[model samples]
Target: MYQLSEVESNYRRLFKDFLRNSYISGLKPLLLHSPVQYAKALWLAFLAVIVVWTHIVVVNLTLEYIDQPTEIHMAPNLVHVSNSPFPAVSVCRSNMINRGLMNNYAFKIYQHQTQYEGTFANDSRYPPLDLERLTDRLMLLTNFFLNTDGKHLDIDELGQLHNLLTSYYNGSVYSVHDILRELTPDCGDLVVRGIIYGMPVNTSQLFLKRATSSGTCCIFNYRRPSYSQSPGQRELDDAEMAALPQVVFESNSILNGIQFVLQDTHQDDYTLSFLTNTAFRLQIFPQEDYATVQSNKHGEILVDHNTIVEVPIQPKFFDSSAAVRGVTPKVRRCYFPEEGRKLLNQSYYSLDECILLCRINSMLQHCGCASSPMAGTALNVSYCTLLDLPCLMKWRGIWNGFNEYPYVEQYEEGAEDASSMSQCPLCLPNCDGVNFEITSNVAPLRKAFNATGYAHGLLKSLNNDRPLSIIKLFFKLRFAQSTQMAMVGDWVVLLNRFGGILSLMYGFSIISYIEIFYYLTGKWFVLYYRECHKQKNDSNKTELDSSSLHWNE
Candidate 1:
């Protein structure tokens, strides 16, 4: 590849040099020379033309294999009709193609990113790509298709990438934007436009603000029709819990335009209606998203939808948060897909939110790992599945008989004026007078999970059992979780922590000691590359000099 480029550069350089010198160097004598000489020169020129054509053909073919869009196995195009049941219809989607190519082609973003680095292939250790991975798209053709390769690709370059795609989708076809949002009980309508590799993603867009006038009655719209609770249409056993709705509403914030959708196994057929009737609108499409999502937790391409709504409020470019012209980001899982002319409402998950949930669960997990919750001490652990850890485990006692480990319980604080422990379903009597009352605010959350039947009521009963400091800390956490205000503050703090960790990781990666070893070993490879370039240039120069000398003779 390098040789071919170098040769092309050398040939172009020689041509330019000859043109510049000819006008000033008395080249009029050549045309006046004998016809025999001109005939021989024409024959030589014809051979050179053939050689250049061969070189161009070879280089083009090589790049085709290295970097290009694979032909897309296009799905039948969906068209909207005026008579459809769901009204206020606006249709938009994107596809890429070319003249000669018979079918629609898409760029396999995974394969593309992996191709640059030798990361993926049919290797023994890794599993195969499942159905979830296939439909999830990473490469989005944006209004301004940003090329991360640090090179500008006009029409010519895109053609080389894939002749098929280039022929079609040559310019902007759909004025659409994407946004990514999380698949929550409340999240329904959203879309994703930007790319997150190795993860199944979907998107939606909606306005976000602190809920309500007194900051209490926050409005939300899950971008879908409200789920009218009827047994015939679908079953609402666990997910559509009426008892624990307060927990879902606790951290309430107003998102202007999101429609709710439910996803199991990364499949979206269900959605919650957070729109018109803000209160009891827990919707579901098919509940297929859970099964689909859980099936490939290692990673999967989540196939979800992004709602495209042309808002009349304001429009702006996507550079920074300030430049973003919308309600201050609600900081949910979803993201906005595009930033150009045709605005898009996208749906996606926010990494920060996931990390927050992970951090919260991390504490629970660590706590679980620490104590033997068997005889009078630890709770019994249940293995739900491969990915799921048990709720609690029991403490193994000194005697042969294993004592009863209480369910996971909360402990009230010992500090002065500590908030009262809120009660949950699992009310185990404390042997040490360790009273753990569940707070009223979070009590609804506990109820919601229970309504779903999977909740093993907060196995809390730790009241006054341990140290004062630990008790204070646990109470403080409960307080923060109870009050939505503190929860938001915690999220911001987590963001800062995450940013710091990322900076440290990046700072160390380039200068790490192992890199030093590779630097030493690979320095020779770079040196050899330079030498090769130098030799090729010299050879081209020598050939040009020889041709000049022969012409003079």
Candidate 2:
């Protein structure tokens, strides 16, 4: 018990010494006070504890905020260039199919069905196509190419119609692409004239046939190869690159961009009311990106017949800062084009492109085929016909889910859980890209033409009452706004904040921490070893004295 008390006293003495010599602000005061000043010491110690707690709380919150890593903000300055790349302009007639061609196709189908009616009347395996419902059937068949959500025919009825059509064409059924090209108005007839930078351009040479959700449309200033071509053939030859349509504007004037006169003449009998309009559907997008009906839906504008529409575009480009690029793509919540391509296994990367591919992949996984309006020709995937519409319609909600949240979680193949299967979480937005904000100004076409003294003879030659639209696309500003992704609280910032909080709370620095560590480890261990050695020597000396006393006695 005496040895135990001595050890406790020694420990108390060591603690008091540590308190007196410690670099911490309030600790020395606690040890220096007398009994009468004990309350003052306690109050100082309590305030120090509150400060330390506040410091811990603030540091934790700062760490939590830093975990997010990235934020999007407008750049400090606008970007100005000598000349900006022109946007790709796509024009689709609201009435997708040609009325005369549709009528002819319908009549051919009716005649074939009547011919096969007697032969397949009693065969349960081969059902006869309904003659009275031919129009509805035709609409259903074309709706697949239009990419519109319409009422679909029954699976059995669609199969019956497909079999009938196959029989009609002598075992060779027409694909949706072929039928749309055959029935849709020719690009020559649709684009009456094309002008760029006040110079007349050959409409045939300027416009290219591209597949869109609203069937085939003519697009200008598009650089990418058509979906029908191989993905490897995207690199254009020097001549092809030189031949691509482009416009340069010295100023943001209405006359500095491309203009077109579009004509739409559809018969009432062949045109569906919902699909037909007296206006042109114009889609404006970046040159490098694919123009899709779903992605460019917000960019679509209407150019009414006999009206001149001016579309002024404001471009905004987004870029990643060096700090943001230091982090992983997942940390930043976005991907560079190369990163996205690697993840998605595609030739190009953009949010729209990713989402479109995601939807197409979902279709292929669920229905075993992609629709005609979808892009999978390079993969050699079968296109969905009237027979596959039932399957496609059944999973329409899943497709919509992908469209709404392209960055949702992805699932493994053939997963039985339908609830977890609809997400496509890998479709992250591109770190850098361009987007165009467009606004339209409309006026009477004849009045504008008369005032400008242009296209007088062309207007006179065409029927004034017919549905025609004149569209002009130009830039509204010389400069574009750039959005930047920056690190909100990187490691450097977090360290600075942590150090500041530490210093504010306890007047601490790196050396203070080192000092505390030395005292607790190296100094404390050395003192303990010395104390044990001294105790051993004293005990040995006492034993020697006892031995001597025994010898004397």
The deviation in Å at residue 505 for candidate 1 is 54
- Return the clash pairs for model 2, or none: 408-425
lDDT by residue (101-169, candidate 1, tens digit) is 111122342343344333323223333333233222212222111111112323332323222221222
Ten-residue stretch with the least lDDT total in model 2: 402-411
Name the candidate that leads on TM-score. Answer: 2
TM-scores of the models, in the order given? 0.16, 0.76
lDDT of 2 by residue, 135-219 (tens): 5566666666534655646666676677766766677644665566667766777897877777777787777666565567777
**Cα lDDT, all candidates:** 0.24, 0.67
Q: What is the lDDT of residue 458 in candidate 2?
A: 37
Deviation of model 2 at 349, angstroms:
2.2
